[model samples]
Target: MITEESIQQFSKNCENIFTQIRRDVIGQQEVVEGTVIAMIAGGNVLLEGVPGVGKTRLVRTLGRVFDMPFSRIQFTPDLMPADVTGTNIIVKGEDGNSQFQFQPGPIFSNIVLADEINRATPKTQSALLEAMQEHTVTVMGVSRKMKEPFFVLATQNPIEQDGTYPLPEAQMDRFMFNLIVPNPGLDELMAIVNMTQKTMAEVAEPVCSGEELLKMRETANQVPVAEEVMRYAMTLCSATHPNSDCASEAAKKYVRLGASPRAGQALISAAKVKALMNGRFNVAYSDVNALAAPVLRHRMKLNFEAIADRVAPDAIVKMIVEEVGTRFGLNPKKEEAAAKAESKKGLFSGKKA
Candidate 1:
């Protein structure tokens, strides 16, 4: 059970972590917030953008925040499955008995930085799929559980797909958020230069521990998600479909397919955490709308026409949000039940959700 006191503590820790990260990184508050949200939710995030956008810096800063064990795998074409998940080794003991034991690989770390994840071959990439999804790695029929609060922050170069294997859509769906770390603004860039120029920069210390992070994840689970809020998340997912009347014009033109059921599930879960991050106990449609882009960008597949038209998935998501965001009045106190109760007094019943 999560106490109000504990949530206040977690939020303090979150802000402290963000402050330290800001020392090394510049602006892109949204990216930083997305990382923290995913971490608090006990879910992995995929950072997608061009090179040198501070993806590595963000992950590294996050590692220092909790003093969590960090490991970076520079994925490449030659990277192998055994290289990632570890393999058993034959050993001779003093008893003159031959035994095989598994040596844990980088996968055992609490925070894994999968740098240039797309550079790896599909075969090598598959190694992480099981671990990321199940948090367990099987070696020689033996299953080994990963450390608690394990997170995989994978980065990919958007412009350089050559000699790289694109992540499979199925694997992409496993990530909780597909964050885009955009280029810094002029002021942010100036601050970044000044921040990095210091040869002796007093940097982040571990402000929290794995246990504390785990407790926060439990708190996020306790975050209240109303029934209608769940339906709103589902509706957002449904609206992504080209066939849906709610689909935006851009979606109808660009999307040949829509988000999967997992998208809806992720939207609700992430929105709950987001609401809690903003010091709220209940999920809000605004929270869901804010998260729709990051949650759906990697999950939804655009058509060939979209590629030809040079349409970004972010635009489609914005279209959908604008389509559905204001439809539900943004009343802080008039919750789902209250809205429905008031609806009974109206001619249309105000439409449940």
Candidate 2:
């Protein structure tokens, strides 16, 4: 029976993990925080950024902070599925008999950093699909279970497209969040320089173990969500589908394929972690809205018109959020008006409504 006290402890553990990660990572708070949320929610993350934006450093730091087995697979054009997963090798037994032994690959670790994941062929990338979703890997017709609390924090270079294989729709949906790591601000750049210029490099200290992380995941799942809020999450997901009744104009006009049921599951699961992080006992509509872009961005596929007009997935999701509103108690139009009123009140009273 997890209680509010346990939830608070989980939140504290999250903060501790964050603090340790910040010791090494200079900028990209959103990336770090989103990664933390996804990890605690027992979901994988896809990070898109240009080279040298601390994407790999963030994963390495997280590995140290959590004190888990971390493996890095530098995906390349020639990387094979067997390289990502493991393959059987012949080993000589004590009795001088040769037998096949299953050699585990990097995917079997607690934390896996699939660096430049797009560099790998689609066939090789598909090897991770089962591992990311089911926490198990199949090789040579035999299925092997991964260690508990397995997380695949994959990174891809958005600027490089030549000779790179684009992730299929199904592969994209396996990730819980698709976060974009932006270039650091001037101050952050200066801080990065100062931090790295020193002869001594900072190393993240372990604040939590793998067991504690699994416990946090369990606690996050125990957080309750109200029926209205769950419905709001579902409605937001359905609105992404152009054919759905709740579809927004942007979705109906621009989107070709909407998010799947996994999107709804991700919404609620991540919202629970978000609420717990904010020290709330129950999920909130704001949590769902805040996570909408990352959760749905990769899940949606735009049409030809959207591609011609240069409509990004984030922009489409934004329009849908505007159509759905924050409260969802009243109609979207009325809810939008009410939200504006609340914002004005918060602005005037120095307190949010």
Candidate 3:
């Protein structure tokens, strides 16, 4: 069970993490928060952005903020699966006889930074599927469990299509959140330049350990969800599928493929953490709405019509959210109140006439 004291500690730990991350990251607060939430929820994150937008730097800062072994794999076309998930090598034994020994690769770390992950081939990218989902790497029929608090924070270039391969749907579904890192504003740009001029090195310090992070995840799992709110989350995820019974108009029109079952699991798990972060003891409808985009954007496959009309996934998600909210009467409290007030005004005007 979650106690008040434990909740306070969780919030404090989150605050310390953000404080430390700010020391190295300049802007993109949403991306930072989403990444942290996914980390605490024990899920992988995929960051999409153009070059030089602090995507790699943010991952490095997270490594510093968490007292864990960090490894950076600069993904390229020439990269091979063996380079990522180790292979057995022949080595001399004590008696000078050659024997097969397993050599672990960079994947055997607490936090892995797969920078420019899309640059690698599909075959090489598939190497991470098992590790990301099962948290284990299989080599030569042998499986090795990942260390505690393991996370894969991958970065990719969105605009650069040349020499880059699109992440397969199976691999994409493994991610909990696909955060889009946008360009910094003028003030943020100045701050980043000034900070870098002082030192390019990451100055963030570790505030949480692997054990403590796991504890936080455990605590988040205990945050209660009301039945209505739970059903609403399910409805939102179900509505993403155009063929489903609860399909929204936006989904039927624009989406070619909906999110996988993992998306619903990720939605609730992350919402629990989000509630705890805001000092709430229970999950709310607002939490689900706030997280819908990052959780579903990469998971859904937009049709050619959507692309031809220049309708981005985010826009489709927004329309689906509104439609579903209306269908389920799950709009935010403020919106509900405004709607009631408008109805009352029309009623009074009709009575006066």
**Best-performing candidate as measured by lDDT:** 3
Tens digits of lDDT, candidate 3, 27-68:
777788789999999999999998999999999999999999
Quantify all predictions' global Cα lDDT against the true fold: 0.80, 0.85, 0.88
Estimate candidate 3's alpha-carbon lDDT, on a 0 to 1 scale.
0.88
> Against the hidden reference, what TM-scores do the models get?
0.88, 0.92, 0.93
Off by over 4 Å in 2: 326-353
**Over the stretch 1-353, how does candidate 1's per-residue lDDT look in tens digits?**
76888778766766666667666567777787778888888778999888877898788878887778999999999999999999999899889899987888999999999999999999989899888889999888888999988999999988886899989987898898999988888998887777777753547778788998888778788888888878777877888889986676667888988898878877877776777666578887767777788999888789999899888898888777766655654443334344334324321111211
Which prediction has the highest TM-score against the true structure?
A: 3
Flag clash pairs in model 2: none
> Which one wins by TM-score: 1 or 2?
2
Prediction-by-prediction clash tally: 0, 0, 0
Q: Candidate 1 or 3, higher lDDT?
A: 3
User: Which residue pairs show collisions in model 3?
Assistant: none
RMSD of each predicted structure: 7.5, 4.3, 7.6
* 1-353 per-residue lDDT for model 2 (tens digits): 67867876786787678667777987676677688889988889999999988898888888899988999999999999999898999999999999999998889899999999999999999999999999999999999999988999999999988989999988999999999999999999999988888843658899999999889989988888999888888998999999998888989999999999999999999888877766577887777777888999999999999999999999999899877774365355554454344334321122322
Worst 10 residues of 2 by lDDT: 344-353
